[model samples]
Target chain A: MLKAIWDNIKGLYSLLVGLSITGRYLVSPRKTIHYPRQVVDDEILASFRGPLELTRGRKEPGQTRCISCQMCVRACPGHCLTVIKGDAKAPSRWIYDFSLCCLCGACVEACPAGALAFSHKVYLVATSREELKLDLLADLKARTEKEAPPKNE
Target chain B: MDLSLAIFVQIIVAVLLIIGLMVGNAVVMVYMERKVAGFIQRRPGPYEVGPWGTLQAVCDSMKLLAKQVFLPGNVDFILYYLAPILAFLPVLLLFLPVPFGPILTPLHINEGIVLILAFAGLGVLSNLLAGWSSNNKYSLLGAGRAVAQTVAYEIPMILALLAVVLQSGSMDLAKIVGQQGQYPWQWNIALQPLAFFIYLVSLVGETNRAPFDLPEAESELTAGFHTEYSGMGFALFFLSEYANMLLVSFVCASFFLGGYKGPFLDGIWWTFIKAYLIMFFIVWIRWTFPRVRFDQLLNINWKWLLPLGLLNLWLTAVLVKFLV
Candidate 1:
């Protein structure tokens, strides 16, 4: 009975102490990020795994450095990547099914030419299932077009 | 017709109370957890949105609501669909028996204590159904662990509670509270402190809280039984969890801490304060302790708490018979 009483007293004491600490923190400022609307910027975003991105080499133009070796296709554990080898003249057609892509970056590293790079633009990827299937040729074309320097005078 | 109208009104009031308490506490607790986690980890948390991220829960809810509700192809249609609701319903119903304040007992069944335990135990069923129906091995494992933990902890919890019931000599929680009022140190905690300690520990474990949170162990189970859930399904599970936490705290306050028995102010305010204080401790424990191993969790209850609770009950009975 004495031991029971003692335990209960200690329990009550501990409960009160715990509550006091929590109560103090409750009144204190909160530490949650209101995601989407009041977006957390790059500094905090670095820690979270939101989405994947693709980056290009500074000096390489029209050169993704992806040597159509199909290593990324084989290495891609998710099987989200579809690569159609382009003629030696044409850029290799690499289709990325974002739906299947695990964002593991296996494909990015597998590119021997350093052509395939992860981008930082982690927006809502796609809505429709069909849209998530990215045409490699079209993506490359767009990237080349976007990266191409404005026509010189 | 008049009786039916009264019943309807009572139900509406009860529902409103449950929703109001659950939503309000969830919002506050979510904010509190983030801030507390941040404070413990030596960093500023959520300083940007709506004055220190007060609206963070709102934003998170909106984002989740907007997100696509994915239904995995391999999942069992009915059970998979029903899992979240099953997981959530017990938490909602568990509040029906909880006495929030002195005069503000919303839905008081005669056997409130038993009702609370029964509903609380149902939380495991939902977890199991979710894991099994999802057909995911990890989810199944999580659910299995949850069931085992629930079974292990609930025995000690009930035994501890039985000690309080033995002292009070009634199962009706309101009467138990009334009985406590007759004594000088009214709270059962003063009389049966060991039982109270056992109750607290078992309550935490029963609720799958930290140091005992094996079911949803993030590192191991990867979000546990609700791994396959998305959108509203996930939201329901989230809502139910906070509701469970609140329910546990309410019961703890009622059984041991002298329900609604404060020094000066004697009513609903005291009850709410005590209950919230209990909740704060629950959250504090969550942040403070690392999760206990599965084996350790069972052993703690069976080896230590069960025997101690039984002994405490025996001692309480003898004391009441002789001293009281």
Candidate 2:
């Protein structure tokens, strides 16, 4: 009975010790990100796997190196892509649905023309089902015109 | 009629005070838990918002309120809807009998200790209802664990309380506190140290805190009984959890720490400070310890706490007769 009482006192002492240790940190700096209000830094963003984007080359102009070999279509596991061959008058358009794209970068790897590449831009993904579809030809034209590297000797 | 009106007004004020304390403690505890966890992990928790993340809880409550409620088709509509309220109501009711301080005493019931225990037990029933009503197997398992664990721990807890009653010769918390004021060394903790230790362990288990948190084991049970609940329903469960933590800590203070007794102040402020100090300890233990396995949790209660508590009771009885 005496031993049991002693053990109980020991337990209380240990609990008090634990409490003191934690009480010290009650006023310490907290390591929580107030997300949505403050965006994560680029280094942190690079570590996290977010949405993927298509890339453009510095030297190539008015040209996407895509050979239309259908390798990306074959490689796609989600089967979210549709490719229609371009006639002589119409520019080739690849309709890529962001809804179906897993952001796996398989299409970027399979493109032999170097026309397809992943971009660093993230956070454009839409929540609505209809907004996820991307018009590849329109996107490509815009990319070539807007994001093309600056011309210099 | 005039006397009845006075009683009515008193009741309203009491209820409001309990609600205000619950809300304030829940908000403070949420921030404190995060900050403690971050510091323990050697990182800064939330500094960017309103002077060292004090507004984090307010923002979180807003976010939870803004979230859309999602109800699945297969759920039992009424029970599914009622579960969060069931989980919340008992904790609020439990607070009615808790005396914050001698002067700040809100409601004084004759059997206040029993009232506290009764309402505390109701929390387990809420967990059971939440789990079984969700129509999910994991919920069922979680609820089963909750019932079993409550049964095991409550025995030791009650036994510990019985020791306190023996020492103070009263179950009325106000009287118990009054008794402690007679002497400097007469605090129940000093006389009934074993009971205090048992009560502390049982308090942790009773609150379903870490090392005893099988009811809502996220890794295995996926939010446990409240898995299917969302929006306001989820928020209510969250509120009740912190309320229950506050309730246990308050009880601990009342029984052992000389409820509301301070070196100089000797009033409600002392009670509030001691209660929050106990709450800080509870939160600290929660973040520091990894959860115990379901079987081990029950084993600690049944094979250890129950027997030790019984032995403590017998010892207390003999000591009170001879020593006191």
Candidate 3:
């Protein structure tokens, strides 16, 4: 009986120890970055894989490196890609259904022209299913224009 | 009992003020508990609602007020409706006798401690009523647990307080506070450390705060007794809960920690400081500890706290008889 009482006393002491540990953490700096007010580190954002976009051509930033190979369309497990071959080797339409994307990086690997890469669009929000059907050619053009030098001032 | 016009007016005003105090205490405690929990978990809790989430509790109370009062089918309507009111109103009565300051007590009853202790038990009746009348199996189970736990824990709490009453030689709360010295070492806690520890344990158990929150055990019982309540019905329970915590913390301050009497000052602020410190400790432990099993909770009360409290009471009685 005496030993049991002593054991409980020791158990109560351990409870105090637990309180002290949490007390330290209560005053410690918060780990969260307020999302709207601040974003995470550049390194983490760079490493993040969001939706896929067509890689820019080495010579002309506006031109697509895709050669209508259909390797990416074939490799995509979700069947989210639509590439209609045009007059030349370049594709006329590059439709990417983002809703069906599993973000598995299979399409990025199978591209022979190295024309597909993951974009860092962490705050991507789609209100409806129809809005998720992204026209990658138009997206690439918008991005190219945004990155281009200002027209001769 | 001379019923003077002035005394009657004071009573009415005090009741209204106590209601305001209970609501204000609920708001402050909600902010403190959430902020403390957030800090412990390394996150900024409730930041978007107002400046540093100060008005978060206000917004939440507004939401609860605006919510639909849902009545589940087959409930005993009268008792189901009565439970939340029963839980809340008795607590205001409990606050009356608490020596908030030397001069600040709402009522000056000679048997103040008795009044507080007696009415404190009424909270459990509401829990039982809410549980039984709700017609939900989880609510019934929760109410059953609440009844048993409250009944079991009250013994040790009474014994602990009785030990202090023995030492102070008064059942009157203000008189008890007057007996203690202002400093920490001069408090009743220094004289009867065992009783203080017992009271602290039972205070948590009595308040039904975690890890003693088995009645509202979210994992097992799904909000327990208040499972069927919504809108203002739920809000009343929440208000009474924080009010009850504030009440017991005041009792602890008065009994053990030298209520309204502290180092450097002898004012109402001392009582507020001591009571809020106890509330902070309660919030601290709620985040720190896991809920004990029902059997374990009972065993702690019956085997450990009850026995210790009785021993402490016996020792106090012996010392008071011969030494004092």
CA lDDT, candidate 2, residue B174: 83
Please, what is the TM-score per model?
0.68, 0.71, 0.91
Please provide TM-scores computed only on chain A for all of the candidate models, following their numbering.
0.66, 0.61, 0.80
Q: Cα miss at B308, model 1 (Å)? A: 0.8
Better model by lDDT: candidate 1 vs candidate 2 = 2
Clashing residue pairs in candidate 2 are A30-B44, A30-B45, A30-B46, A31-B44, A31-B45, A32-B45, A53-A119, A55-A117, A65-A113
- After aligning candidate 2 to the native by TM-score, how far in Å is the CA of A128 from where it should be? 22
DockQ-wise, the better of 2 and 3 is 3
Candidate 3 per-residue lDDT, tens place, A1-153, comes to 999989998999999999999999999999999888899988889988999998888777788999999999999999999999999999999999999999999999999989999999898899999999999999999988997862321
Regions of candidate 2 where Cα sits further than 4 Å from its true position: A1-153, B1-5, B182-184
Among all windows of 10 consecutive residues in model 3 chain B, the one with the lowest summed lDDT is: B1-10
Give the runs in model 3 whose Cα sits over 4 Å from its true position: A1-4, A55-71, A74-77, A86-90, A106-115, A125-131, A137-153, B1-7
lDDT of 2: 0.78
- Candidate 3's DockQ is 0.78
lDDT of 1 by residue, B1-324 (tens): 998898779878888778878888888888887877776554566667898789998998898899899988789979988988887776767777666666667666788888888878778888898889988888899999989999888988899988888777888777777666633387888888898889889988888878688988999989888899899989888888888888878888788887777787667776777778787677777876668788878877887899998899899889889987
Could you arrange the candidates by lDDT from highest to lowest?
Answer: 3, 2, 1
- Give the winner by lDDT: 3
Range of the 10 consecutive residues with the lowest summed lDDT in candidate 3 chain A: A144-153
Which one is best on DockQ?
3
